[model samples]
Target: MLYYAPDNASLCVRLALLALEIPFETALVDRSCNAQNGPAYTALNPNGLIPTLITPDGPIYETGAILLWAADQKPSHVFPAVGNPARAAGLAWLFWLSNTLHPTLRMTFYPTKYIDAGSAPLLLTATRANLLGHFAHLEAHADWLDDTQVSISHCYLAPMLRWSALYGTDQSWFDLGKFPRLLAFAKRFEVTHVADQARLAEGLGGTIFSAPTPPCPPEGSAT
Candidate 1:
């Protein structure tokens, strides 16, 4: 198998691959350099996104899809094979992170494209508020999104939280203190062999290195 990843989105998939102990060659696509937009990369994924995986079957994009496919390929602890409640729960959180949290963070950090220049500030403010609200919601539950002991959701969320700090989104937004379980969970995941290598490869500067807010709480909670 071959993987095309950038410095950002590909980290999770790369970690997943490493966690599964699968050996694959990496094609590093530099997004800042506009390599992903070139004709060659665009032919692989029309959307021109990072972390595209070329398996014997074909190419796959999107972090969630790549992780799930990797899980299915290995069918071990990272993802259980059949009739595992934890697997279903893990899948739920994975999808939630991909569909919900990831999009919100993307908008909050890069809102210039969606709104007029005059109203961009307002849009960003609202987006940040919405993200905080979500963080508060996640803070209320202490089970790490899914009720699993360990799963793909943690891998997906780790990078998001890392980037949140980079965007200076305010640590209090997610109430990190209240979600001790999640914090410990993240710390434990960080020390894993694969996580260490992935962090170095992705240039994360070694784990957020400080406590940040937990995942946002569910909506409509006291903040």
Candidate 2:
């Protein structure tokens, strides 16, 4: 089972699972009532995070770790094989996404978690500038970005782009169109079979990545 909350980081793992054709069950972690902090859910994930993928060996937490584990389970094109030369580059960008990009977005979305409310605007300004630089770096040099194939990196990144557009307090700073390559990517990715399934399951509206809106999910809330 994959424990998830609608529109949460779990959405990344969901996309990977669907693309890989992995059969798994989902148990919603109702964020509205703080269900993730409850005993039952915390038993599976000590961090009390949204996604906790139960496997026969054990349970897996962390979005990137879950995506890696899922890809390793079967032969899939999503991630390069261990011996492949591309594996090194792939692993680098994957960790960069997990370590650098994802946390930057987190800080942007929840600035108060890092500093006082009075200083959040300052933090957002800095992070938004940082985000523009990050996207520019990827837009120019991340050769791993494939317009035709959905990789594990794409699974991690596309939702982040959506959140960047939709979640922050003052979202006016972001403009997906500025990154033309990424803009085209969002246009293509949102139409894929895997993305379509996620949209329906989470009640995510059209152009989820390219032009996201406040989600109207059927189950748990996005927060």
Candidate 3:
């Protein structure tokens, strides 16, 4: 079972599972009532994160961990295996997506969690700049970013682009066109069967990555 909320990090894991065509179930972690903080959900993921994938072995928390575990289940083009020459590069970018890029986005999305609300604007300014740098770096150096193959990095990155556009206090700063390569990638990936499945599941409307709109989920709120 995948504990998820619409438009949350869990969406990334969902995309990976769909791409691999794996059979699984999902339980909505109703954010509207702070359900993630409840005892039952916390028992599975102490962090109370949106996504916690329950497996035969045990429960796996963390979006990146769940994605990697799912990819490793069988041979697939989405993820490179341990011995593949591309695995090192792929793993490096995957961790970079998890550790570096994702946290930076969190800082922007929930500024009050990191600092005082009155000073959030200043923090957003600096953080938005940092985000621009991150995107530019990926555009120039991330050879692993491929629109055709749709690697695990694609699952991770396309959502970051979506959230960056839709989440922050000031979404105007993020312009997909500035990074043409990533823009192209989003345009391509959004139309794929994998992305489309996630779109319908989460009520994420058309152009979810390249031109995202606020989510309108069927069962629970995106917040």
Worst window of 10 by summed lDDT in candidate 1: 214-223
Which candidate leads in TM-score?
3
Worst 10 residues of 2 by lDDT: 141-150
As a TM-score, model 1 comes out at 0.82
lDDT of 3: 0.90
> 1-223, model 1: which lDDT tens digit per residue?
4444433667678878887887887776755467778998888888877768898779998889988998888786587666776667666767878998888887766677577778877887788788767666666752654344445667777767666655543434444445555566667777778777765564454544234323221211111
Misplaced by over 4 Å in model 3 are: none
lDDT of 2: 0.90
lDDT of 2 at 205: 96
The per-prediction CA RMSD against the true structure, in angstroms, equals: 7.4, 1.1, 1.0
Can you give the lDDT of residue 215 in candidate 3?
Answer: 90
Error of 3 at 163 (Å): 0.6
Clashes of 3: 0
Q: Residue 75's C-alpha lDDT in candidate 2?
A: 51
